[model samples]
Target: MSQIIIDQLTHAQKVRILYKTILRLHRGLPEELRDLGDKYARDEFRRHLQCSPMEAQLFMTEWAKYAVTITSQLGLKGKAMGTIGGELDSNTVEMLKEDQVIQLYELMLAAKGLEGDTITAKDIHNSK
Candidate 1:
């Protein structure tokens, strides 16, 4: 069934799907590593943009397999990153609890122009 659907999709559509899936997987990574993962994924995709149709198809197939494996290994569901639709699921919510904390810490660091330092009361007070 899925193979039928895949066959029907245009090459561009397949590329779009693969790109979105990779981005979603990157989003689920720990905050500190997200940027690195995103850059690597983006560069790899860009590098393949000029490949022949057959090469593109082969790359997409392999990428799709890697995406599924990574998602499973990370205990993430298809809905985990809310990339397909803009709605969160229970599993996504649970996953976000820890991610949210890391995101917040990252945001705070960016806000204060600091790198890899825990925000302490003294740091906040000194900044003011």
Candidate 2:
């Protein structure tokens, strides 16, 4: 049977959980691309792949472009800003099911107050 995640979190727990998951998705990219994604993001890469340097340099540049687009579209900011997504900010994830983690990320984005354009994990954590 398939499991539905995110059925286990509180409203506050949901946003943070989602942000961490998305950030992980971003960190999974190749090193070169990951670096670029950290700087510029993925969408930017699509527009300027030629401007990128050859080999690893080119990889980082292009990948950054990809990272940016993904983060922006996903409503992620800061470390979450580029291709690498965002950082994990909570311990609650271990308590939830795997699918719940995914759902939490989506819900965080879908939540009304959580839809701001500049929310970062640090900001969320520091506020507490």
The 0-to-1 C-alpha lDDT of every candidate, in the order given, reads: 0.65, 0.46
**Top model number, lDDT:** 1
Model 2 / residue 90 / CA error / Å: 37
lDDT of 2 by residue, 8-58 (tens): 655335434433444465565555545533443234334443553344344
Give the Cα RMSD of candidate 1: 13.2
Best-matching candidate per TM-score: 1
Per-residue lDDT tens digits of candidate 1, residues 1-128?
Answer: 39999899888887888888888876766665567557656876898889998878777886887687657645444334423212335564454444454554566565455867765556434533
> Which lDDT value does model 2 have at 70?
64
By summed lDDT, which 10 consecutive residues of candidate 2 come out lowest?
Answer: 76-85
